[model samples]
Target: MPSKIDPRRSGRSGGLRWPLVWNVAWRDLLSTLRDRRTLVSTILLPLLILPLFTLGMPLLLGRLIGGQAAERQKVGVVGTLPAELRRSLTRDESGRAGVELVSVTDPVEAVQSGEVEAALRAVTPLPTRAGEGSGQLELYAKLGNLKGQTGAQGKVESSVQAYNRALTLSRLEALGLDETALSPVTLRPVDASPAQEQRAGALAFLIPLMMLSFLLNGGMATALDSTAGEKERGTLESLLVSPVSRGEVVAGKLLATTLTSLATGVFSVLGFLAAGLAAAGLRGRSDVDAEMMQAMGGQLTLTPATLGAMVLIVLTVALLLSALLIALSIYARSYKEAQTYVTPLTFLIVFPAVALQFADFLTIGDALYALPVFGSMVAILDLVKGQITPLHTLLASGANLLGAGVLAWLAWRSFGREEVIFRN
Candidate 1:
């Protein structure tokens, strides 16, 4: 009698096959989508979190700082002030008196009692005659109130400097000398970089760090659910018994996880952009005029090429994180156990993500580009700063893919082991 072949085992080629991989991947994707908890944790959470940090906090802080700056300041005077010096201390160059000067017996008590933001005490009486000696001026401010201290100290210093300049000019005229004779040269500063580059420098650290964090967080749930979750449900054994080879099964799961990770990353970027636009709109109502809005919009503008590079970086990071997460999840015996195992992995990702926020402190070199998480972070940071080098991009991308492949192989090997797959 001829040996009979089992139809269910007929497609087991003992190697990777595309059709089998696709089938497994599709099933995993569908299952993940149907699970509401996984969907929300991976997709919805990032969309909410990114916008809150990017838009809300900045607007709140801006309002607080602006309010503090716009309030009128109060200053106390301890001793009699000369007519000319009093005018100089009370009024600005534009003749607007922002400081309200009150005569106080004790300037220190006035500041301590919160009666004035700052106080000016005359160490010596002011000169009444043109040829009289200059008087000493002492300024006191409440050190506890930083905003009050800065404003009061700044106004007092400006007034003193103005008085000094005017007195110097008078003495120079008495000496039959021109004011400019004292200065040999004048210095002017010029910033050659474009406005866009300046704005990008401010945003470079935050954008990449948030993007990478979301990419990692977005894939984490699906990775754990697809592996450890299935094992906990007793469905992994049934899936393993299918005709598809173990490598094909692992590949399929990785593909699904990667897609989920990419989707989450894209959503996070969109959410952040939307939040920024909304913030701009709110600011335009009062703080931002049309000219300012136009200038800011131009500064924040991103080129299509830069956006493409960001997409590439996000995808590569997602692939690397998803593969590693899946391998870890595969070794876990239960869903709760997988979460316990993966929780610490987040810290690993966080340290590098935080480091990207200080990208200027890190050197961008071939060696950094060859490292795993650090390399991807540097590449993303360069892209945001508009300084991405093709060689560095290629190196970082290759390193990430190579690392993903290794983790994927480990996942496949774990799946092939009956003990690991069925561990409970």
Candidate 2:
């Protein structure tokens, strides 16, 4: 009998064959594109999430809070207020307070019932004798209603402070003392950060985390389907029996997945930019005025060089994650099992991405640039802040690519193993 030719053990090449790799990659890409689930995950989801977060939520919040500011607020007063104090509460130099002072027997109940935005209860009489205590004013606002708790309550507090200051001044003058003597020291705060840094601070964490999530989610469905989906459908064995080496097959699938991932990320960024442009245009109308347009323009400060660096970082990270996902999926015997493995991998990516938001990128040392996902996140943040150095970018990209190479090698090796490829 002649010895059988084992396709898996035959036609092995020490180096990658581009033609076979390209053929395999093209096929996988076509298959993934044909799948509706893959298209939705990699493309549509980012389109929805980016606008909802960056544009829709901000506009919604502004409307809610802005509406609250413009409306008249009701404040329940528990006791009869002095004529002078009542006049002060109703209006001042800034203008009339947009508040309705209602006399209520039960101030807290009025607040709880939403009849009042806040309540002021008299605790004690104003200070008179040395032993006597100063008058206490208790303000109550519903905690769940943020507008009431913050905006209305803040306005009431400001009025009370002004009243207290005036009263203190009167008492001191009656004693023939200067009002300035009461305040021995004054303090003021200065923000040292540049305007660009301040704007970047608002968006640094959000942009990077969004990009990381899109990069991972974009490739996950395709990665699992290419590996375990084919295995469960009985097509993986047929592919393995072909003349192509396992390395080339793995490389092809990796390329396809990387491309899908990259496309998702690119589409997400484009979607975000489109949404931002729309918002800018809306804010640039003649009614909005030049100051508003200038302010909106200042928030988006990406230069050509920064955009190029960001694209490079996104692509490299997508490649690294794609390989890892492929390797993990290869171990799964079925598509469902592969999904279970890939789900936890999302947490691994998400947690670090979220945590990096709170990280001070400026203070973080260069050693952290050696980490895979974390390094890429930091580099993206640095780029956003316009502080990324060439060396830092090189280190992060090198580490990420090195890790990807290792994962690709492992996946290729797994493809060559009979038990893994055909495991039940």
Candidate 3:
């Protein structure tokens, strides 16, 4: 009898292995193309939604800022002040321009009507020590909205300061003191560094989060379809029957998924940049320069090294997410179950991404720097803040990549297990 051909040992060498990987990858890509609904949902959703959000956000913000600047702010004044003192309070002479001082019978009403950005309730002078007749006047306005309410507060503060100065001058005239009494203190505010100034923009935070969101969203869908969809449709079993190594199968699926995710991320970023630039350009009255946006985007480019780092970051995250989702989806009983499992993952990321935007406190301690998603967030923030120190970037990237690698390995291990691969 002729020796039986061992199919398992057939072509187990190097030449055919790569081709197998490519074939697997190609088949998955083609299958993806055939699913027009998924294709449209993944590709077109980001293409349309990202630009819409980016363009609309700036316009909304500009309207809010401009409306704030144009509003007639109400201010309350207390104490038995002469008409001259009140007139001086709201006039340009006192440097209190662009304010309308309304004498309020009720500070609550002023605030409630939104007539006042904030209300200033003045209290009587505090009792002074033995010889002093009176203490300085006390005033209060809303504190929470300090940035928005500052201009309105400044008007009130200046008016009080001016009145105090006039009172001092009257006393000096009565007692023969000089103007030198008013020169006690001065304040100087230094400007921030050029890098800090340059980094200030909506894009600083929005860009990175948008990049992350697109990656996760794209990766999740690809992972689910490749794993659960295949299992549910009984195609995965056929693929497993081929003379392909499990590693090659995984490698091919992972590569395709990462590419799909990366492409989505890139398109989203470009759309964001384009929509922002176009919106800025369309605003003829905006302080942002058209040429400046063009130059900033073109000349101050993310270098190839930085771009590579960013791509690596995105791909690593995508691969890990794809792998993890695939493992989960394999265990999921149905497509609806897989979708239900992944819904929380979407919201799970959203809060952290939003927190990353609002969180200003930074310890820079080693432990905080070592945390998983938070580290990525901190690194991206540092990158945006123009403080992408080489050591920090390397460390953060190393940690994230290491974690992703571990998770990917675990996913691959899960894929090889019959119990996981064929779970009900």
Error of 3 at 404 (Å): 3.5
lDDT by residue (147-221, candidate 3, tens digit) is: 445456656666666666766677766677766666667667764644432523445555566666777777766
Over 4 Å off, model 3: 1-16, 30-59, 73-81, 88-105, 109-187, 192-197, 201-207, 271-301, 346-373
Better of 1 and 2 by lDDT: 2
RMSD of each: 5.5, 4.4, 6.7
Instruction: List ranges where model 2 is wrong by over 4 Å.
Output: 1-12, 88-97, 126-133, 143-145, 165-190, 275-300, 361-363
**Candidate models: Cα lDDT each:** 0.73, 0.76, 0.61
Clashing residue pairs for model 1: none
**Model 3 pairs whose backbones collide:** none
TM-score of each: 0.77, 0.85, 0.69
Using TM-score, rank the candidates from best to worst: 2, 1, 3
Candidate No. with top lDDT: 2
Residue range 25-129, candidate 2, lDDT tens digits: 998898888989888878888877776666665556555655555566788898656555666666634322456789888887888888888888887765433
Residue 135, model 2: lDDT of 76
Q: Where is model 1 more than 4 Å wrong at Cα?
A: 1-15, 34-52, 55-59, 75-97, 101-146, 149-163, 166-184, 271-301, 353-362
The true-versus-predicted C-alpha distance at residue 199 of model 1, in Å, is: 1.9
Over 1-424, each residue of candidate 1 has an lDDT whose tens digit, in order, gives 3123333443335557888888988888998889788678676776787666655555555554455445567889888878887787666443223577888888888888999889988889977444787788788886676576447666677777777778888888988987887786877886565544554435456666677777777787778888999999988877776677677778899998899889888887777666656645654354523223332331223468767777777788899999989999999999999998888876766787777666667666688888887788777666655677778877888888999999988897787666787778
